[model samples]
Target: MPIHERSLIRPENLVTHENLVIDGVDVSGHWSTFITSRTVTDYNEAMEEEISALPGGEHINRCWQCGSCTNACTVNAINPEFNPRYWIYLIRLGMEEELLRDKEILWQCVSCNKCTYACPRDVVPEAVMKATAHWMELKGHTPKSPSTHFDESFTGSVIATGKIEEGQVMRSFFKKTGQPLNQPWLIALVRGLVLKFPITLLMRLGLSALIRPRTSGWGRTQAALNDYVSEVEARNSKALGLDGKGKH
Candidate 1:
């Protein structure tokens, strides 16, 4: 364990990511860094342009590293790399590629809305974080995070079912992740409860269903979104004299 507050620090050091403190105060030596400023400048510039282009992105540049959003972040409490403050700093500097390559860390955000709840400027930092991660993914960063994968699967699962079917989603997710199915006891318990308990009990099951993301008004909402996208794509394609798909 490193001593508190006095760990010899520099921009190039490769410090252990888990040792979070030196002298009981969080210090940034390794996990808190990125590629050199000279190499990152272009990326930073593009990042700023892309982010500020978003509806709420103008506020992204308004951050002064107050750390309020970081402090309020739930992910930061668990993993140090998931720092909203640092990433926002990266954004302010316009380090687009750095942020893009950092898709692994960036996608760790849970989007719990806590950062937004804590932002004094009402910057909606949580939404910005998610948007940045998604943008990075679209730009070829390729999301490698489990949360991102599960999030997509969960969304797809819910859309397929009126509500999330935990057993179904977990089976799919586990198969995808190469995790050996090991929830035998839980599965048995579920089966037992379903067999012994009333069907009404299953209908009233609130929490388990939440794990699979069963949302109300989703079918109509999804159809509306599909229609909206097709119309926009048709208009856009017409303007470009291309097919209704937004591809070249």
Candidate 2:
């Protein structure tokens, strides 16, 4: 279906004449307005396939342009340019360059699931948005988001020691996202904890922080997890036509 919304049309593409006459008829302003036509030649035909290979993008082929997802998108309500339906349309047609025009706003999906709930084809627009964001990051079209940094920090801590240290995860996440460790809110939180926790418990927590305790017999499990992560990364890279180091 064609997008008939005037706002969706780029101003440069819409041409208008202040005063005009065509075929002995006086037509100006809205009557003389026209959209410029152009041919697209830079399509990435494997885009849909590459996205499908990522988690949460498996059902991209089911989209039928019903517009339900966009109608229910929470982000779209706040930001008109954040259109999931339009992005999916571009992806299905492999219009990679056009899609990249909105690359910065693509990661703004809040995973509200309203779009998913409204989708008739079970497209799961929420997941598709996330997959698209991940694809953009892997393709180097955008940087890793703060949420991605936090997830990696939390996951890395658990995978390394089979347990998570809240303070360590927070520190790592802050470092990766270039945030200061001494925020006022964090300082207040630490002060409250210090005043509330018992002496022995606080000592144990301090000791744990220093020692970086690990789960017993985690060596074999860690090895298996590392192997799995490597395999998934290799598969994703292959799907995106990237080398082992994620370079094309």
Candidate 3:
């Protein structure tokens, strides 16, 4: 079966016998594979509400299993396991355990907005993925993902200077993620760019590195943004039933 069409039944719940005979009927090998029945009694009833409390999760309740989000998802094209539709269903049903099966890759959404555009109900699967990822980190289900670190680094630079400095953002992300600056692909990319357009690339890089980009007279804007961010954080924390003082 295609990954998207695969049954939700857990593999461990499947029972198979090499040979079996019951009442003049022969059931062996392939025919013997049967799924064992099970009950799910540990649903987290607050799952939907808690997820909805997060910034990107607001529209999650509007999903209707239309599959448009998953169909339009760029990440899902590469990895069918990253099905936004399925995750939405699981979330709405409070199947927290089932949802966690794909937790590690939840932050892989590229925010292409294709899912958002294709959704008839404005489900905004891209935002939903972001919210679910944030929810995972906030609830301590997983450590902060590298993507989250990159986002923080990028956003911090933007908020601090009212503009993004690519070199700074890259360095900060690498430092926060404990990654080496000399990765093979990165080296190749830089080499290719320099070889193709040495003078232009060199001047641009030199100038950008020498003088960091910043918005003029951005202090007031930064202060206002900081205040708005703090207010939003407090509201998110309260919605999740957490102390407003918790670290974001």
* Cα-based lDDT for every prediction: 0.65, 0.88, 0.87
Error of 2 at 185 (Å): 6.4
- Minimal lDDT window, size 10, model 2: 1-10
Number of colliding residue pairs in model 3: 0
lDDT tens per residue, model 3, 103-217: 8998898999999999999878888889999888888789999999999999899999989988889889998999986889989998899899999988878998888899999
Best by TM-score: 3
Q: Against the hidden reference, what TM-scores do the models get?
A: 0.59, 0.78, 0.87
> How well does candidate 1 score on lDDT at residue 142?
75
Tens digit of per-residue lDDT, candidate 2, span 1-248: 23476786788998777888889877677755788888999899999999998989999999999999999988899998999999999999999999999988898898889998999899998999989999999999989988778889998998899988887898799899999868899889878877888696688778878888789899899989989988888888888888656443
Pairs in clash, predicted candidate 2: none
What's the distance in Å from true for residue 168, model 3? 0.7
In order of lDDT, best first, we have 2, 3, 1
